[model samples]
Target: MLIFRRAKVEDFEKIKQIIKDCGLCDCDLERWLNNFMVAEEDGNVIGTGGIENYGEYGILCSVAVLPDFRNHGIGDGLVRSLINLADRMGIKTLFLFTDKAVNFFERVGFRKTNRSEIQENCPESKQLSSCPLSFIPMRLNINEFFENIKCK
Candidate 1:
């Protein structure tokens, strides 16, 4: 069985490897390690994701699942868990930069947004600062997401 839980210090290398395999930036990941969530199966870390808190806003980052773990709902579970965490943390909006998986995020209710909007709103977000121009910026409003879920 697969389970999602807060990432532990010992899971760093596994998380890093998964992120690297997915071609995501791993710089400064350790700084926000405490906020990360991991998907573990039979005591092995198969996926990881996290958010960078910026007061009322946050940047979802590092969402990745191992090749063998893809399409098993691990990535979706990790994202949902992180969204729940963001809601609990009083984050009004969540943003992310992704070169891939835009469709996946869209299915989860994130909408594409202009990169300049992210820069203006998330000036202090380290993830945004280091994100490449090619990556698409997306955002989800926490309250709106809950409302949409209820409607469904």
Candidate 2:
């Protein structure tokens, strides 16, 4: 069985290893641990995802699932949980940079967006690091998602 929960301080190294193994973006644990979550099974972490707050905008970053565990909805669960966190934090919009898995995030309501949208509103995020040209930008609004879920 898969277990999903908010990540604790102790889960960083394991989660970091998972991110590295999957070739996901690197993150500073000290900067992001509070918003990170992990999927575990039988004492081993199998997946991870996290978010970075930029006030009205949030960055959805570093979601990864083990290769052997793909196609089992683990990645979707991680995204949903991160979205929930964004909603609770009063984040209005969330965006991500991805070189791969664009299809995966699109299924979860992220739509391809102009790079300047992020660059203009979230200069702080761009200041944090540079995104490669190959990485496409995608965005979603937390309130919009919540509204759709309510309608459903």
The most accurate candidate by lDDT is: 1
User: lDDT per residue, candidate 1, 1-152, as tens digits?
Assistant: 88999999999998999989988887478788988999999999999999988878888999988898899888988999999999998999999999878999999999999877777877877777888889899999999888888432
Q: After superposition, how far is residue 90 of candidate 2 from its true place, in Å?
A: 1.0
What candidate 2 gets wrong by more than 4 Å, as runs, is 126-128, 150-152
Q: Judged by TM-score, which candidate is best?
A: 1
Error of 1 at 111 (Å): 0.2
- lDDT of each model, Cα atoms only? 0.89, 0.84
Show how many residue pairs clash in every candidate, following the order shown. Answer: 0, 0
RMSD (Cα, Å) of model 2: 2.0
